[model samples]
Target: MSRYVALGSSMAAGPGIRPSAPGAPFGSGRSARNYAHLVAERLNLDLVDVTFSGATTAHVLHERQRSARPQIEALDGSEELVTITIGGNDVGYVPLLMAASLPAIARRLLAGRVRELFDRAARERALDDVADALRGVGTAVRGRAPQARVVFVDYLTLLPAEGAPAAPLSVEHADLGRFVCARLEDVTAAAAQATGCELVRAGHASRGHDGWSADPWAVAAGLPLPWRPAPFHPNAAGMRAVADLILEQVGKN
Candidate 1:
């Protein structure tokens, strides 16, 4: 049996997948059907999934959620595989991106004045902080699990690519959404490269399968899933897609 460690935020945790983790510190939401679970089961690996909803890179490094220790506690020298999907929460990108797509706010996206509403400089600085934190996480995980094959799985796509039918979002909202998500991928990519971690290009792998497509791995902004909290986030299919991505990169049959 191979030892595998999984860590990261809700993207890796799959909050809405069903039958949440048994001891998740009261409100640290989790799911047993997350991509980690799917991948571990498919590969027949010993899984130590400590993924949590809303977890930041800091949480994985040292911070704790209530009674739960850091996510690093789940890993040990014997691990053969490790996967992490974090950093988005460090900049609070998900909620901000979802809010940006709201009708009340998105309706004003076409206006140039939208840029004047928020502190763009502050937001950029926050993203910079995320970049720094991600590098630290990559480095620390490597130090702790030196023998483990570390795969830094990036976040999945939320909106369509540049040119596509914007069924779920207004044209302007779709553009803004893609831009935000693209930058997020760029940040993660840079961190992955800097840390010598294997980068699983989820943004590229999930291209046409965005929320706007006929068959979406992720849900559209306004379309809420029966189980998930937000209208945005990955569905069951999305989790499976990520699992497949790992398999592809790992040369697994």
Candidate 2:
């Protein structure tokens, strides 16, 4: 009666933090210190962590990678809790943002045209697809784990109020990235409402302390994890924040 299943992409998987666990389809993304593990430890629940580095909603619905089982299959109507942070990779979130921004920062001295790598029309279509996929995921989870409390966890803020300084990206580039992330959060909220899952708005909870700040919960695009090669994901502080947030919702301190 204490089974807790965790699933999602690199953020939920705790990419940079160690000791990374190995799986068949995706070798190592799950961290021993991820929010899921922390929450499980705090609540004394059996943890079934199946998060991967590049997992899309498709991965959760029907294994996207070889040897990777459908993430939802972990449930059997016998779990107590479930938490997930997904959809970022679906539209190439971090990578696209970086690609669109880095060139500007690298050559800001020249005042060149900051080429827009992302096709606006294509991006909009892809976001729509994400919303559809999210609806499917929510329905599947509710059906599979009828007794479990499902929480759709959102990603942490990646930039400070003034934008990330480490990228040394221009104010324009940083502001654009932040705006895109904010829209993504909005999309997640709509999906959560449509599917009846309690939304854990981590983005709102994790403000100011973005990759740029001294007390950041999230890391910059290339900030390496302690003793690991993880980047563009939540750091230890971010993971703890997620765990605490979930615990708070579950009525536990």
Candidate 3:
């Protein structure tokens, strides 16, 4: 079997998704059934999955996260495939959604702090930086594994395109979250185009499968029960969907 590598943040790691992947670093939260694992199994590839919960592009390309090395350190010219799902944490997308899910009194107390962390202008600047960083990641992967087929997998949609705000998130917060997600998707697409890597439009494919939808792919705000997936993160169904998408994309190439 050819080698395959998975890299990126929590969205790719599949935290709280039951049955952690073997050899996953402590606190990485990598799931055995995450999309990368699913794709690797379907394609019969030797998978090197280094995705981790809460990783940013900096961690993927350069910096260390938790006790693990930089994600790209797992890659080499022997790989046949690589998938990336990052940049959400860099712009505070889910973090802002989590803040918005806070209790009313807590929201009031933390509103200023949250805004300071996710101000619109600041997020815009960060998106630009994320775009550049994503390009850097693609370039680095090409240099290390020239034969690898790289795919940029964007985050799944968390809100409906047009609908009333879901529980635990006000209209304003929901709107802001949507805006951030859309911008992140755009940035990811642009980077993929610039880097000549394949793009899996997970965010676009997940439009009607928002957290509040009947067949939700993402988890809405809820209690942090051990059995439950992380709030605002992709669920099992979403991972399967994304794995299918990647399979289709790879098949075409």
Which candidate tops TM-score? 3
> Best lDDT goes to which candidate?
3
For 122-211, candidate 3 gives per-residue lDDT tens digits of: 878888888888888878877888888989999999987746767778787788888889899998999888887889999999988988
| Model 1 Cα lDDT, one tens digit per residue, 159-189 | 7778786664556656655666777799889
Model 3 scores a TM of: 0.96
Please list the residue runs of candidate 2 whose C-alpha ends up more than 4 Å from where it truly belongs after superposition: 22-26, 100-117, 162-166, 223-226
Model 2 TM-score (2 dp): 0.87
Model 3: pairs clashing at backbone N, Cα or C within 3 Å: none
**Model 2 lDDT per residue over 93-201, tens place:** 7766556445554546433322333555555667789888888888899889888888899999887775336465556656666666777788888887888888888
Q: Model 3, stretches more than 4 Å misplaced?
A: none
lDDT of 1 at 12: 83
Identify the superior model by TM-score, candidate 2 or candidate 3: 3
Off by over 4 Å in 1: 22-25, 103-119, 163-173, 223-230
Please, what is the whole-model Cα lDDT of each candidate in the order they appear? 0.78, 0.78, 0.88
